[model samples]
Target: MSSSSAVKRLLNYAGEKKILLILASIFSFFSTVLMVVPFGSVYFVIRELLTNANDISAIPGDRLILCGWIALGALILGFICLYIGLFFSHFAAYQILYNIRVRLSKHLSTLPLGYFTKGSSGAIKKILDSNVEKIESFTAHQIPDLVSAFLMPLIMIMTMFILDWRLAIATVIPILIGYFIQAAVFSSDSGRKAMEDYQHSLEKMSASGVEYVRGMPAVKVFGMTMDTFLHFKSTIYDFRDWAVSYTKLCRRPYMIYLVMLTSILTFILPVGVFILSGQPDNQAFALTFLLFLTVAPSLSTPMFQLMYLGGELQKITEGNRRIDAILNEKPIAEPVHPKVASSYDVRFENVSFSYQEKGDQEYKLALKNVSFTAPQGKITALVGPSGGGKSTIASLIPRFWDIEEGKIAIGGVPIQAMATNHLMETVSFVFQEVHLFHDTIEENIRMGNRNPTRQDIISAAKLACCHDFITSLPDGYDTKIGEEGVFLSGGEAQRITIARAILKNAPIIILDEATAFADPENEANIQKGLNALIQNKTVITIAHRLSTIRHADQILVLQDGEMVERGTHSDLLALNGLYKKMWNAHLSSKDWGLQEREVHHHE
Candidate 1:
C-alpha cells in the first residue's frame, strides 16, 4: 500500500472514532497556543522589575503579583485542555483497536480454513497484536502530540521574531541547523535499513517466541534445552544484535541534535550583549532579551518531538502495511442464494486439489479425480497409508479448502452453495489430534451444541463413557482442564471430545482415528460410544486400525489419491490387493510381542 493509503486505511478502521481524534487535535492545538500566555507574563514581570532596577522601593509589588497569578492560571488551564485531549484520544484508540480485532476475527471465520493451513498463524498473529497495537500509539499519543509539536514551535518562533527580529533569527538559525542535522540522520538510507532490520528482528523474535511457547510440551517430553529450539534462540540473538546496532548507529546523531537544540542560549547570550552595547541603559530591550532566554529553552521539547514524530511516521506506515494486507485478503464468498441440503449423503465427483495452485511447479495434486458417495445412515471407511489422501479426503467433506476441478455436494447441493455456518452445523468431527480449551470440562463438552442444558451435556458424556471419570474428579463437570491434577489421560480427553460430538449430533460425522490414542480397554469403551454416535447418522470413518471398521457398510481403499478398491470387508480381502496387504500388516502389528535380547560383544 502507498504510505498515504496505509494511513487512510488505519483511520478508516476507526470509523466514527476518527472524529474523537480530530477533537483531540483541536484541543491540543489551542492548549499549545495558550502556552504563549506564560511567556508574555514572564516578559511583563521582568520588564516591571528591570524598569526600576536602580530603586527597589519604587517597584510595583501588586503588578508583579498579578503577572505571577495570570501566568500560573494559564499554565493550569493549558494542562486541563491537555487532559481533555488525552482522554478523548485514549478512548477512541482503545475502541478502534477493539473494533479492528472483532472485524478481523469475523472476517477470518468466513474465509476457507486454508488461509491458515500451514505456519502462517505467526504472521497473522503479528498483524493482529503488533500491527494493530502500533495504531494505538499513533492514534492516542502521537496524533495530539503532533498537532501541538508543529504549531507550538511556529507560535514560539513568531513570538521571538515579533519581540526582536535579530534575536529571533539568532535563535532560529541554530534550531534550523539542528533540525536539518536530525532530519539528515533520521532520513538516511543506512538508518532506514537498520530500522527495517530492527523491526524485522522484532517480528521474527515475537513469532518464534509464540511458536516456542506452543512447543513447550514437546520440548519437555524430549528433555530438550534452549539450544534445541535453534530458530527461536537465534531470533532472540538477532533481535538483540539489531537493536544494539541501530542504537549505536543513531547514538552520535541523537547526541548532536540534543546539543545543538539545547545551546540556543549560547547563541542568544552573545547576540543580546552586542545589541545591548548600542543602548546600555535600555531596560526595555534588556527585559525582552531576558524573556527570550527564559522562553527559548522550551523549544527543545517540541522540536525534539517533531523529529521523533518524523521517525515514528516511518514505523507506523510499515506496520500499517502488514495490517492492510490481511484486511484486503479476499474471503470465501458466501453464496448469494444459499442452498439447504435435504439429506446428509456426501458425494465428491471428479475432485482434484493441491495445497498450492496447480500452476506452481512445486505443487503436487493431493487428490486426483477422487469420486465417491458416502450414503446417508451408513458408515463409509477410508483406509490408506500415510499421506495417501485419507485426511485430505476427510478435510474436503467440510470444504476446508474449496475444490477447483469438480463438485463436492451434500444431498445434491454443492458445498460451495451452502453457507459456511450451515456446512459447519452439518458435519461433526472427532479428530485424531485432539484440542480441548483451558476451560471447564462442562464448557468443553458444551462446544458441541451452542446452548445445551446441563442434563444434555451430562447425557452426552455418559454416552461417550466419560461420565464416570468426570464425576470422580473433585469438581465433577466443572473441573478445569490444564489445571493441577486435572490433566487427563489421552484416552479420557479423546472420550470427552467424542461426548462433544455426540452432543452436537450433526447429521454427518467424520471420525479421523477417534480411538488412536486409546489403550485396549479405552479403545473398547470408545468403540461402544462410537456405536451410540453412528446410529442413524451418515458417518465417514478414517482408521489405521483395520479391525475398528471391520464391519463398516462399505470400505473404500485409497492409494496415491485414487479410489483403488470399493467393497465390503470380505470382497476387498478376496481381491487380495492393497486392502488385503494393509489388513495383513494391521493383524501382524496387533499380534507382535515385545522381547528383550542380551547383548554379547565379540571383540
Candidate 2:
C-alpha cells in the first residue's frame, strides 16, 4: 500500500475524533508562528544596535529588555501549545488503537478454526500487539511533528525570502538536498525491501522463540543444546544479520543528512559576504548577517524532525498494511436470515474437503465425498487410524470448515444456513486435547454457561467426578489451575473439560477420544458422566479404541479420507474387513498389556 493510503486508513480509525487532527494543525501553526517571534525580536534588536553603531550605549535599555522578555515568552508559549496539541492527539490515538484492537479481535473470532491452526500464535500475537502499537507512533507523535516540520520550513522560507532572497536560496538549498536524500533513503526499493526483511526476521524470531519455549521439555529429555535446536538458533542469527545489515544501510544516509542540516550556515555565510561586498550600507549588511547566523542554522532543526519522521512513516505504513490484511481475511459467512435446526440429527451428503497450505497452492484432502447419516438421539462412531479423516468428519458437523462439495446438514437444515452462534450452541465438544484457562476450577467449569449458579457448577463438577479432587485443593473450587498455579494430571484435566461439556449440554455432542488419557477407573467414571450428558442427544464420536464404540448405533470406518465400511460391531466383525482387523489388533494389545503386568507380578 502507498504511504498516503496507509496514513489515510490510520486516520479513519480515529472515527469521529478526526476533529482533534484539525485542532493539532491549528496549534502547530501557532507553534510555528510563535517560534518565529523570537527570531524577529532578535533581528530587530540587532538592527537597532547596528543603527546606533556610533553610540551603542545610546540604544534604549528598556526596549532591549522588552525584546528579550518577548522572545522568552514566545518560546515558552510555543512549547506549551505544542504540548497541548500532543495531549489531545495522544488521547485520540490511544482510543483509536483500542478500537482497532477490539475490531480485529472480534473479526478474528468469526474466522474459521483452520486459520488459527495454519499460522503461528506468536506471529498472530505480534500482529495484534506490536504492529498495532506502532500506529501510536504515527498518530500521536508523527502526525503533529510532521505538520510542524513542514509548516516551520514553509514559514522560514517565506520570512527568509522577505528578508533577502539570496540568503533564502543559500539557506533552503541544503535543506532541500537533505530532504531528498532522506526521502531516497526511506522510499527506495532497496531500503523498503531491507525494512520488510528486517520485520520478517523479527517475526521469525518471535515464532521460533515461542516454539523453543514450548519444546523445552522435549529438548531437555533429548539432551539437546542451542546449536542443535536448529530453527530457534537460525532465527536468532537471521535476525541479528538482518538488523546489522539494515543499520549499515541506513547509517551513512542518516549521518550525511545530519551533516547537511548542520552546515546550512556554511553555504549562507559565503553568499552573505559576497552580498556585503557591493553594499555601501554596512549597518544593513551587519544586521542581515546577524539574522542569517542565528535563524539559518535553526531551519535545519526542522529538517532533523523530517528526517526522523521518514523512518517512522515507513514503519507505520507497514503496520497499517498488516492490520488491514487481517481485517480483510474472509470470515465464515453468517446467514442473514438464519435457520435454526429443528432436530439434532447430523447428515453428510457426499461432502468433500481439502485444507490448502499457505504460500503453496497445494491442497491435502482431509475428507473426500464422505456420505453418512447420524440419526437423532443415537451414537455414530468414526473409527480409523490417525489422519484418516475421523476428526475431520466430526469437525464438519459443526461447520468448522465449509465443505468444497455437497452439503452437511443438522436436523435436515444445511449447517451453512444456520447462524454460527446457533450452530455452535447445537454442538458440544470434548477433544483429546483440552485447554483450561488460568483461572479457578469453578470458573473454568462455568465457562459453558455465562450465568452459571454455584449449585450448577458444583453439580457439573460432581457428575464429571472431579468434585472430590477439587475440594481437596487449598482453595477448593476457587483454586487457580494453570501455569503459575496448581497443576492437574491428564485425567483430572480431562474431567474438568468434561464438566464444561456437561454444563453446556448442547443437543449434539462430539467426543474425540475424550477418555484417551483416563485410567480404567477414571475412564469408567467419565463414561458415566458422558452417559448422563449424551442422553437423548445426537452424538458423533471418534474412537481409537474399538471397545468403547462396540455398542454404537452405527459405526462408519474411514480410511484415507473415504468411508471404507459401515455397520454394527457384530456386523463389521462378520464382514471381516478393516473394522474386523482393527478389533483383533485392539484385543491383542489389551491382552499383551495384561500379560506384561502378570509377568511383573510373578517376578
Candidate 3:
C-alpha cells in the first residue's frame, strides 16, 4: 500500500480525536513562532551596544531591561503552549492505540482457528504489543514535535528576511545542503534495504526469545544446554550482526549531515563581511551578524527532529501493514438468512476438506469425500491412527472451517446456512488440549452457561466428577487455577473442561481424545462423566484408546484421511481388517507396558 494511504488509515483509527490533533498542530505552530522572539530581542540589544560603542549613557538601559523581560515571557508562553498541545496529542494517541488493538483483536476472533495455528504467536504478539506502541509514540510525542520543527523553520525564515535579507540567505544555504545529505541517507536503495533487514531481525529475535523460554522445560528434562540449541543462538547473533551493520552504513552520512549543520556560521560570517563592504554603515552589519549567530544554530534543531521522525515513520508504516493483513482476512461468511435445526442428527454428505496454509497453492487433503450419519441419542466413534482426519471431522461440525466440497448438516439444515450463534449452541467440544482461564474453578465451569446460577455450576461439577476435589481446596469452587492458588493435575483439569461441556449440555457433543492423558482410575471416573454427558445427545468421539469405544453403536476406522472400515467391535474383529489390526496393536502395546512395569517392580 502507498504510504499516504497507510497514514490516512492511521488517522481513521483516531476517530473523532483527529480534531484534537489539528488543534494541537495549531498550538504547536504558535509555540514555534515564539521561539524567534528571544533572538529578535537579542538582536536589538546587540545593535544598541554596537552603535553606542561602549558609552553606557548613550544606550537606553530601560529598553535593554524591557527586551530581556519580553524575551523571558515569550519563552515561558511558548513552553506553556507546547505542554497543552502535547496533552491533547497524547490523549488522542492512546485512544487511537486502543481502537487499533480492539480492531485487530475482534478481527482475529472472527478468523478460522487454522489461521492462528499457521502463524507464529510471538510474531503476532510483537505486532500487537511493540509495533502498536510505536504508533502511539509517533502520534503523541513525535507528531507535535514534528509540527513545531517544520513550522519553526518557516516562521524563522520570514522573520530573518525582514530583519536582514543578506543574513537570511546565508543562514539557509548550509541547512539546504544538510537536507540533501539527510535525504540521500534515507532515500537510497541500500538505506531502504538495511531498514527492512533491521525490522526482520527484530521480529526474528522476538520469536527466538519466546521459543527459547517455552522450550526450557524440554531442555531441562533432556539435560541440554543453550549452546546446543544452534537455531536459537544463531538467531541472536544474526540480529546483533544486522544492527551493527545498519549503524556502520549510516555513520558516514550522519556525520556529513551534522558537519553541514554546524558549519552554518562558517558560511554566514564571510557572507556578512562581504555584504557589509558594499554598505555605508557598519553598525547594521554588526546587528545582522549578531542576529545570524543567534538563530542559525537553533535552525538545526528542527532538522534533527525531522530526520529522527522520518526513520520512525518507516517503521510505523510497516506495523500498519501487518495489522492490515489480519483485518483483511476473510472470515467464514454467514448466510443472509439463517436456518434453525429442528432435530439433532448430524450428517456428513460426501464432505471433502483440505488443510491450506497461507501461501500454499494446493490444498492438502485431510478428509476426502467422508460420509457419515451420527444419529441422535447414539454413540458414534471414530477410531484412527494419528493424522487420520478424526479431529478435522469433529472441528467441521462446529464450522471451525468451511468444507471445500459437499455438505455437512444438522437436522436437515446445512451448517453453512445455520446462524453462528445457533450452531455454537447446538455443539459442545471437549478436546485433548484443555485451556482454563486463570480464574476461580467455579467461573471456568460456568463458561458453559453465561448466566448460570451457583447451583448450576455445582451440579455440573458433580456430574463431571470434579466437585469433590474442588471442595478439598482451600476456597472450594472459588479457588483460582493458575499461579495464585491450587494447581490441578492433568486429569483434574480435563475433568473441569468436561464439566464445562456438561454444563453447556448442547444437543451434539464431540470428544477428541477426552481421556487420553488420564490414568486408569481417572479414566474410569472420566468415562462415568462422559456417559452422563452423552445421554440423549448425538456423540461423535475420536478415540485413541480402542478399549473405551468397544460399546459404541458404530465405529469407523480412518487411514490417510479416508474411511477404510466400519463395524461394531465384534464385527470388526471378525472381519480381521484394518480395525482388527489396530485393536491387536493396542492390546500388544498395553501388555508390553504392563510387563515392563512388572519387571521394574521385581528389580
**CA RMSD for every model?**
3.0, 3.1, 3.0
List TM-scores for all candidates, in order.
Answer: 0.90, 0.94, 0.93
**Candidate with best lDDT:** 1
Model 3 off-target regions past 4 Å? 1-7, 164-166, 188-193, 280-282, 357-363, 594-603
The number of clashing residue pairs in each candidate reads: 0, 0, 0
lDDT of 1 at 339: 94
Candidate with top TM-score is: 2
lDDT of each: 0.86, 0.86, 0.86
Clashing pairs in 1: none
For residues 1-603, could you state the per-residue lDDT of candidate 1 as single tens digits?
Answer: 444565576568778888887788888987898877888887887787778889999999998899889888988889899889998889888977988889888888877778787545777887788877887878788878888899998998998898899999989988888778767876677866776786678778888888888989998999977797899999989988997888888888788888989999999999999999988988788888888888899999999898888778778777776665666777877899999999999999999988887678899888899999999999999998887899988888888888879889999999989998899999999888889999999999999998999999999999999999999998999999988778988889889999999999999999998888778999888887888888999999998889988899999998888889999899999999999999999988987998788889999
Error of 2 at 342 (Å): 0.6
Candidate 2, position 464, lDDT: 85
Please write out the lDDT profile of model 2 over residues 1-603, one tens digit for every residue: 777787688668888887777787778788888988887888888888878879978998899899999999999999998998898789778877888899999999999988888878888888888888888767888788988998888897898898788888988888778778777877899888987887778788899888888899999999987899999999999998998988898888788878888899899988888888878577676687778888887777787887778678888777777788789989999998999888888998998888874355687788889998999999999998788999888777877787888899998999999999999989999999889998989889988877888899889988888889999988989899964557998888888988998899899999988887789888887887788778899989999888899999999999999999999999999999999989999998887743334334554
lDDT, model 1: 0.86
| Count of backbone collisions within predicted model 1 | 0
Q: Residues 1-603, candidate 3, lDDT per residue (tens digit)?
A: 445665687679899888877877888887887867887788888889888977878999999999999999999999999998999889889988999999888878778877877778887888899989999988899888988878888888888888788788888887888788777877777877777777677777788789988899998898877788777888889888988988988888788888988898898888888877777487776677777787788878888887787778877877787778788889878899999999999999998888884368885889999998898888999998889989899989988888889899999999999988889999999988989999989889988989898999999989999889999998998888875647888889999999999999999999987898889889877888888898999999999989989999999999888998888999999998989999999998887743334334554
